[model samples]
Target: MTPEGTGRALVVGGGYAGLVTARVLADRFDEVTVLEQDHVTAAPEHRRGTPQSRHPHALLARGADLLEGLFPGLRAELREAGAPVSDFGQFPMLYPAGWSPRVRTGLALQTFSRPLLEAAIRRRVLAHPRVRLLDRTRAERVVLNDARDRVIGVRTTGDALRPADLVVVTTGRNSRLPAGLSTAGLPAPDVLRVDGKLSYTSRVYRRDTASPPDWQASLQATLAPTARRGGTVVALEDDRWLVCLFGADGQSAPTDPAGFAAYADSLANPHIKDVVTRAEPLGSIYRYGGLGGQWRRYDRIRPWPGGLAVLGDALCVLNPLYGHGMTVAVQQAVLLARELDAHGPADACARFQRRSARTLLLPWYLSTSLDLGWRPEGASVQALLARRYLARLLRRIPDDPELYRRFLAVQHMTASPLTLLVPSARGPSARARRGGERS
Candidate 1:
């Protein structure tokens, strides 16, 4: 195997994960080629490749910071494109209990449609002299050496073989890499899945800048069981509001105009309903369903091949309800860069896969533990307890500003989860204990 920074690199899938991965590889590889199945355009529009791009997306604080580092001045660019930035606390969120207190937490949140962000990142990544993008090119499978110990390159759908020293797969949730691996006589990774039977119905509306709403963005978070219906209203570029109403456990929102408005009215919070009633619809409503959390244990495979690494949703896919998918993908790309620097190209593939699994533990736990609540029969005792604790924490967030701030910090992956475990002096539990002492 060649040393790091001295070989050719190939990335399959030129979406968000693939684009970011290519940018990172350009720093170390002599050339980075990205194979995209869709005919990617320079403009910001939804493509057939990513059906979910029509929905709302959150670039959390940590992800924003990492992306800005990777593509310098990206935040400014997005802002210039009219994407609004707000503090975490300023965003109004209606939890299961009630409306969370709005206070300045300093953690930043930038809201935009998925297509806009992807297009912006794609432009920057393609501008790198070492990176090359091939639109409408589909990768069929990885080519291995005679010993089947290392990946030599990838075979395209057109029966063409492209040689590379390293091949990274970022093919998102519906990846075909496993079938190809099995064909090569390699063990497929074990899969763990927890389905909440969630679905999202989204639509874009013209925001009236002349008569702006009280809040820039708002969320009615889904609480399992009784409160399966939820919604969110986020301000996007071009004076548009991206509204998404989601339901869990087969309570999907309707796509028809009248029915869609009715579903919005039925949500626990009225913010989404207000938007639908006031704003003018931009286009047809779109629905994407059958969502679930899936984790492919690629790191657990023994005798893993060299010159191969799986990333993003290809490795682990979280339910989009939590808005962690994009952030986690970006974080994995950052980890890939670090691993390449530490282990070099010859040995980094396997090590990066293992470390990426570790990095996914927190986001996986957060998404699945809450999702398991929809089907209590499938939840273990530990998952049930964690859900109960989180439910209680949500109730406290309305009254305790500090606790709410910490909760947002953890949710955005900016702070450690341990921060949520520490009790605030102003918290109800602490106050109850102090009352007993005073008595």
Candidate 2:
């Protein structure tokens, strides 16, 4: 298990984080093996591997930049392949702010389905000489050293335990790390869960008519019962629009054309409904429920295991509507690469978890804060106040374009949420500053 001289590193997933970490590892380590349960194919179609692949997804500005840095020319290739590359105003947009005014705000967004992005990343990963892709392999246990604490390899569910210098579990949202560890008779890691009883049904539409005006490149409409619904008409390489609609359980979206349209018309804004009526049907509506929040606290453990680490949704998962899952996963992977390189000659697993825990702070807060807005029975006074305050700001977005841009930037993960409160365009007014108090 010596890593001093080009040791093997086993990465236990091929999702966004796993793939990036594999590529980064190949550059420094002698060998990098990525074991995935499903075969990695180039098709843009969704498969059993990722149920949510059919849903709408985007590469935020920060994530996009990171990918571009790792795999240069990736953007040009996607754009040439038919993926839309442009600013917020180019696509139809909507918000509680009304149909967002069609104005150039300089904020850029990369639109595509999840599978398309995965395909691109997979290609890059497979191209690396030191990287190998192993499909249909299921991880069973971590190979422990004489100390019974330091992991040295991974044994597949039905396969033999093989030695390695490192093992990263990137199993994603349905991660079994805790159960897996407990089954192996190890101490369980700390865990966190936050549920926002929200739900939705999604259907794809091949837009035939011109897009709606002031159409947000995407839309998250305010809905009845204080619920919300959102969708994005992304331009896939095949020239089809992947439309997704989400809502709280009581006001959940439906798959049937009639029911779906009715729900769209019910939105605070009308642009999404307008597009729904005219867009050509591409496929049947795909529905998924049980929307919630989660986080695994590995760093808090007093004695973290050696030779083992976690990444991707296995470590932290955010609400899908926020679209920060992939972005945060990418950021964490980037940090993994940085930490591993610095501590390559020493014990790095514990350090990796600490840094990863720190990185998840901002995204975890954003997702948890937003999810608390709607509840199954009733919301608390704090939730009500927070909702009212946010709603007021959202309602004012139409009149204040600067505020709109700032909101988009923060939502896109290009800027920190705190940036909006500081002294800047559309920030707290001088009056509030002079008062020496909160806004």
Candidate 3:
């Protein structure tokens, strides 16, 4: 059925990015629909779509702000649902620069599991008037038009063609978009990975203590210096807690509970193990690996499909270690809205792709730069320099409060990447900047 006005806009993938993008489309198009292969559930539970959802996830202050703007009262609703609020100041955080001195200042990092967060956002998106959510619906293929430059719609298993004015793919990292769309005579994007042979394993535990999980913040880990690692605690509803421990390439988190505990103990700090040992066990350990950074330049080709664009993991998959994947998705949605507001549908897809790439380039480079640091086996010259610079900055961070605060601000996406290179604490000053920091 043709949607009135400009026709229906369909977003494939029900992850954070897909949901946000679909809402943005609803504003520009007559109607918007979101498609997901896995069954979407209202209650917080693990699902097949996001195997990584089992891990603890945090909504950074930057991402939280974007999300709140997109869907009002979201944060409050989450809090009411038992998602704990963290000031980041009080939250123990051991940056590579040593302990961040648990001061009562810093951006807010809301704590919760991926499933819980997704479920919450899904509910909010479903409430939108112009949005239709179709769960357990797999997008079989991209229905290409005569010119093959733009995808007109998606082919569903129902042997039906669900045509639309625009299609946004958010199928995520395991996406087969490249191969699926290659039949149209366009070559796929070249794969670039920093797979330090990394694998991830996570589990949730019931805690008897009233205080929230703290071990995640106390570890001093960075991508460049050594084989990197991390852990986090997300206070869930009902006084429960979700704990996730990650080890960098080759330093995989074990699948067995006992082995996982051992890996945590071996981290720079023993706090993670201490918390795990004390917290009551909730579920068996769930392990997921093959986590790598990937980017698909669907818009890079000479002619991208006019009515189709990809979002989220379908476009750029970041190293989850940076915790910016979800944030990127939300930001991309916001970008899509801006582009549509400025241009007509005929040229919007191409513009959206370029804009989408711009949104991801810096963060993607930043994330991979660090990933290169962790894997000594494949260290690049540039990666080494970044590693050195980051290491040096961390060593001086604790002693230099201004420096430390500025770094945290940028790391939290509160400030621009240029903040590190500025000479004037405020801006360009009489003195030139050094390494993007105030000289």
Q: How would you encode candidate 3's per-residue C-alpha lDDT over 9-94 as one tens digit per residue?
A: 88988887888887677767788888888887788777788888877566667888999998889888888877677666555545
* Candidate 2 lDDT over residue span 170-268, tens digit each: 988887778867776677877777676566567766754354333325565533335456654455566566666777534568878898888777654
lDDT of 2 at 31: 87
Clashing pairs for model 2 are: 92-215, 92-216, 92-217, 93-215, 93-216, 94-216
Top-TM-score candidate index: 1
For candidate 1, the 10 contiguous residues with the lowest summed lDDT are 430-439
What's each prediction's TM-score? 0.95, 0.87, 0.89
lDDT of 3 at 351: 89
Query: In candidate 1, which residue ranges exceed 4 Å CA deviation?
Result: 1-4, 427-439
lDDT of 1 at 158: 80
Task: Give all candidates' CA lDDT scores.
Answer: 0.86, 0.70, 0.71
Q: Could you tell me which 10 consecutive residues in candidate 3 have the lowest summed lDDT?
A: 430-439
TM-score of 2: 0.87
RMSD per candidate (Å) reads: 4.6, 5.8, 5.7
